[model samples]
Target: MLRRFPTPLLVALCALTLTLVGTAPVSAAPTSAAPSNQARQLNQTILYYDSSRAAEYSSAVSSAVDVWNASVGNVRLEPAASGQHAEIRIITDDGWPRAHLGPVRPGGQVTVWMGRQGTAEGYDAVRIAAHELGHSLGLPDTKSGPCSSLMSGSTGGVNCTNAAPNASERSRVEANYGRGPAGESAADGRLLVDRR
Candidate 1:
């Protein structure tokens, strides 16, 4: 038989769990020398955008991609050409912006929702796009981060229009996708629950 935790205890536990889930590193270093050129080529992860519903926010998507592309070199996100199979799909919806924890590897599917809710509240569209994409890239929300931290999500407040990933954020993504021993797994995706 088990007893339930008190309300306060439960809340605290939930907070801690959320923190750990969002902040813990999800990468493992390779056990041996790096793989051959062919293997390195195979490690590239490409994310395709649905682009239909997100048409209105194309600039935001492009800006977000530019931020990530400029920040890291291992992963490349491209617009899904017609009839192309997209590993990750992004669309616009009515709720708060969010993304599926993810497919993490190729041939898997993940969805990113670009909700108007955040924009309506004054959050920068590019930042929201990048923040949600960060989830797909295996980053969790650092709700306490200031405007400069891209993963800070909504906690940076509406004025945080900065869409660039900070140094640490950039390093983490590079570590996850950088060319190295062939077997390092990309971290799992984590949803950012709006605590505000």
Candidate 2:
């Protein structure tokens, strides 16, 4: 029971339908598919460190910060602005290098003791600082790991002066900070005294 329209009329109707479809507004896709610009900005985790109390080890601490900043993308380490609170504090002492274990949040505090004992024993100062900082960033000692492992700490020996973290160590750090500020948890708080 189909009625045939004139060829010219049918062609015009088809063209009008195409135009209407082409001009129709599209519904927005789910935002979960891509994060908004502001959301991405909020997800960036930057931890400031205060090393003013580190005394003679300040240079080593700076070098350690540089190593970590270069190694990870999810987190960044920056020197605290004057008068600003810092999450990581570096100090020096005569004991073996150690740190308070933490996945320290922006306002949380953790200590990195740049012990002269390790340096006095001939361990590299920069390596010691970086290793202690690693503890603050939630890493534990892999005492049996080789010199290539930055978390290996003093067990790598005084001859193991590698200041940069190895691939595994870097990946661990990235994972730790990838969750951003909201994901931060209570600091481990246990003091890791690296006497060995």
Candidate 3:
């Protein structure tokens, strides 16, 4: 019962990565409703599936979020109903279509569509879940290296522990929120994806 994360990003620095590939134009984080310093980790909420592909594997997703919650002094989360409260949905397909993948709301909602469960096309549910939540929290893909970061453009496998957000990535999320706990730091992170 583990939420399988997406493909293991061929990370170099992070020891892991999560990437989603497509020819879509790179997106820029919207400059709205953030403090000037970009050092906030607002105590917001998140939503995701807790059953089937998603439910069967939440550990991975939880690991990634735990890192953000602890590192920054702004962002926080609470679980919502599987199909409600949050905006999580799955693509079933290997990768999220360009149209389906987009920016997430700050301190708003999160969704993961379980389009496909297993197979290469079927993105690791946990990894996708973790990466998508990062977006909702305000993190954006830098395409830093060809691989090695969860925020990469390609939906590569994510190294939950290694996928730890970098300074800029952390700032982006905190900027969206206010700040996380005072002295929180990243905890154990991991996810295992698979279909029933």
Candidate 4:
């Protein structure tokens, strides 16, 4: 037996198939040329420190790096190679912990003094690390926020061991470095906040 679709019906079905196929969503196809949001994070903003005298705070510094690394998509802090020029230098002092606000470039330098004064006051070492590093990354001390905010610095009080930056703090870092390494060109030496 032989059967045939009517000419009009067959034409309509063909037209519908073509229309659907033509209007298919672009996301359905994988494109080799597309770049992903994560791919943009490949540009690592390396910062190194000696931390020789601040050996006691080594874990704190590492924890701070981990906190920032987890919070932002761009810019990573890495320990510098031995003898390599370091953009950020960390040392210890008798006073409160502090850092130079910087996008410090190579051949230039910034100092993060991990002072004992803050820890003596009962501030968390890890929070102190993150807060000082926050200054190094271009964030000013908020000082007014709660312990939940890392940038609040000493205002968070002695029990404030929260080393994580608040949402706005995280967003600012991402916005600053998310686009790429381009925004880091600002000249160094802004302000210093001693976690007092």
lDDT of 4 by residue, 1-196 (tens): 8899899999999999999998989775576545664466555555665665566898888888899888876667777777887777777778878888865554568888889898888888999998888887778788677999888888887787899988998887765664546365673587585746
* Best model number under lDDT: 2
Q: How far is candidate 3 from the true structure (C-alpha RMSD, Å)?
A: 22.8
Global lDDT of each candidate:
0.76, 0.87, 0.45, 0.77
Q: lDDT tens string, model 3, 27-83?
A: 644554455445333344343423334444456556655766665665465555645
C-alpha root-mean-square deviation, candidate 4: 6.6
Model 3 regions more than 4 Å off: 1-53, 81-84, 87-110, 114-127, 144-148, 153-161, 179-196
lDDT of 1 by residue, 62-111 (tens): 88988888887667788878888777687887888888664255566677
- lDDT tens digits, residue span 1-196, model 2: 9999999999999999999988886655555456765675577688999998999999999999999988877778989988999999999988889899987878899999998899888899999999999999888889888899999988887799898988988877777777745346667889999887
TM-score for predicted model 2 compared with the true structure:
0.77
Give the distance in Å from residue 81's predicted Cα in candidate 3 to where it truly belongs: 5.4
How are the candidates ranked when ordered by lDDT, highest leading? 2, 4, 1, 3
State in Å the error of residue 57, model 3: 3.2
Ranking by TM-score: 2, 4, 1, 3
TM-score, structure 3 vs. true: 0.47
- Provide TM-scores for the models: 0.71, 0.77, 0.47, 0.76
